[model samples]
Target: MMSKIISENKVAQVAKLIDKAKNIVIVCHIAPDGDAIGSSLGMYHFLNALDKMTTVVIPDAMPDNLLFLKGTKEILNYSKYPEFAGELIEKADLIFCLDFNALKRLGEKMEVAIASSKARKVMVDHHLDPEGFCDVTISHPEISSTSELVFRLICRMGMFDLFETDSATAIYTGMMTDTGNFTYNSNKSDMYFIIEELIKKGIDKDEIYTKVFNTNTVDKIRLNGYAVSEKLEVFPKHKAAMITLTREELNRYHYRKGDSEGLVNVPLGIENIVFSAFFREEKDFIKVSLRSRGSFPANKVASEHFNGGGHLNAAGGEFYGTMEEIKERFVKILPLYNQYL
Candidate 1:
């Protein structure tokens, strides 16, 4: 039997909230990753089983690689249709903020809209330091992903019988993506039991892995190659590696949203390279993805240097700074964590 990490009181409270809700809107973090999309759509499908009028809203576009899921086409992008997304929030009696603790993670404009909405909000996230915004916050940083929480929450609320294949597929995708396909933060025995349950629901794990990881385009392959061969920098002394890709360089390769999904983890494969960071240039900010192996705390580097917090080995942050400044700051900060060396 799996251990109960979530309190029964919170589960009962969430169940009561779900019982009283009719219209529901689900939102996730900006640049929605697999866990965000998986958890959101998983809950979307689950609520539909109960005949709730549900809508899934995203702050911006996700990588097209995730489009193979059951209901990607049905999700609304707030970046493209601000008014309509706001309308959904306005009409929603309850909103499920999945995979994000702070409303600001939905991007600036969508954050303001959701914060101003009359709908009661519940946050289901596996990130650190949740903000005090949601009425019911189900934040568990130790969990593998928010998708796992979604599964646990449903079973805890006595609705596991309603779960089906579609939800299983999405929830599995979230867990797979968040934990780097169970390579990190997934040593717990109970996690395997959840996977067994998902498999019983008819999710083809191999196919999902192939689709999510192996199905890359020619440009994506070339872009990744160029990023590694040309832009990758290794610090043997620090046992670290860094990759920086600018907007111009990305445009040169016909970049798409998901082109660099696993690029951050590539460095860890190098011998003795325990820490890695990827800096992708965005219009307004630098997108930071950090990864590490063994006892190295990548999240501490992210939290202290970039104002972001997540799991020890995997975390992300955004910085509003120039490329030169980011590089200098990273170099300056590396010595502070040299104790890990």
Candidate 2:
């Protein structure tokens, strides 16, 4: 048996909330990744098993690859249907905020909707420095992924019997994707025990991995190739590397939403490179993703410079600047972190 990671009192609070609520809604951050989608759908499945009226809403679109999960069709994207999504949150008796720490993570427009929500909120996440917004905040920064925390919450509430195969597949996909297929931030033995329990639910772990990682389009393949071969910058003294892609460059290759998903982690595979950053140009800002090895503290770099924070090794933030400007800033800041390398 895995050691108890959740307190019994919080579990009781969640159980009581679920027991009384009539309309339930689940929400995740904008640009929802595998963990966001996985944890939301996993909770949706559980609530369905209990005959609870539930809906899953995301601030924006999810990756096409993740469409393979069990309930993608049932999900409502707030960007696409703002009125309907807002209505659900407004009507919900209890809202489960999954995979994100702050209400602002719901994006500017949806943040307004959730902030006004009268529904009692419970946040289950694995991010650090959770804001004091939710009624029951289950944030475990040490856990590999938010899906793991969702799983722990279910078991701690004694609802593991309702945990079915589809939920297992979704949660496992999040765990695998967030950890880069178990390459980083996955040292906990209990994570394996959780995986063992998921396998016992009859989900095919190998198939899930293939579907999430192996199924890439031709455009995505070419985009990644171009990004690495043409844009990758390496600094020998700092043991650092960075890759930047402007909007024009992305459009040239028919860039899709998730095309550059793993680009930041690519540099770490090279010999002696401990830090990697990927900056992809968006409409008004550049999306920043940073990764590092050992004790380099990539999250510090993310929070300090990019207005974001995450795990020590993997973190990201946003910057409102040109690609050239961001690249120069990163290069100028490299010396400050040289000692860590």
Candidate 3:
């Protein structure tokens, strides 16, 4: 836990930053998850209520379950709207870097725009030690989710009522999924308090859970089986397990949308497995997802070596290489686990 004085000071500083800006652009990491989309849309709606000009740009399209959020339909596809994105980002008075602590993770294209923009950058996230590029950074690795912190900020600013039921639902979805429905190591009392508030706003918890987790297409099930049978590889002694799937495999399996979500968690269920990872080979990059079941800190592993950071138990990164190279690199690094396991 961070000291009260430190956390309060950080919060106050970020509030001051947001209060001063009129035009803001919000961004999350590439290949975003529930938390990324949820937090971004949550903040966007709150800012919209403030009558401030805000645009939410996602590096990639949102996953299926998360598409029910309020602003999901309006989310600007930055890759497709490059010119409009450039104009908005350039003219904005502030840039809210949410859900992700580092700007590089926003992707190569967006990073350049962020660096060139004159907007004062303000970061609101709950990730590991950040890069400290923002004028004001509100990052606490101990927090359960970015939505948790976003809601807290709104409450502190006395704008809690500005949150629409849709905003609350979206925020709740992110907070729920990122904390694994409060199953991860980061959950705290404040998380439940936020959920209670969202419930009070008439956000349907069961339906949101059903939409995000329970509903899966038939193709997704087949993809899961294919990933488990053909791609999953467990190291001797069960210290690590990995699943590698290529675009061709994805096509052959008829991988539907959001098929890869939470696939890394499959290996963590195996007894004696300290760590689990997924190597997803996309057309241009190798997306790596890392998870840990016991005392292992997967975020540290990803941040230190894989150029990424996330919750202690769950994290991800991307590497530039062929699928074989990615596997060899991950395999070679397995020996380092002796220190933790």
Which candidate number has the best lDDT?
2
Cα deviation of 202 in candidate 1 (Å)?
1.1
lDDT of each: 0.91, 0.93, 0.82
Q: Over 4 Å off in model 1, which ranges? A: none
> In candidate 1, what are the lDDT values of residues 126-145, reduced to their tens digit?
88889989888999998989
Off by over 4 Å in 2: none
The residue pairs in collision within model 1 are none
lDDT of 3: 0.82
Ranking by TM-score: 2, 1, 3
User: Candidate 1: worst 10 consecutive residues by lDDT?
Assistant: 307-316
In candidate 3 the C-alpha lDDT for residue 123 amounts to 85
Candidate with best TM-score: 2
**List of clashing residue pairs for candidate 2:** none
User: Could you tell which candidate, 1 or 2, scores higher by lDDT?
Assistant: 2
TM-score, one value per model: 0.97, 0.98, 0.92
RMSD in angstroms between candidate 3 and the native structure over all alpha carbons: 2.5
Local error of candidate 1 at residue 224 (angstroms): 0.7
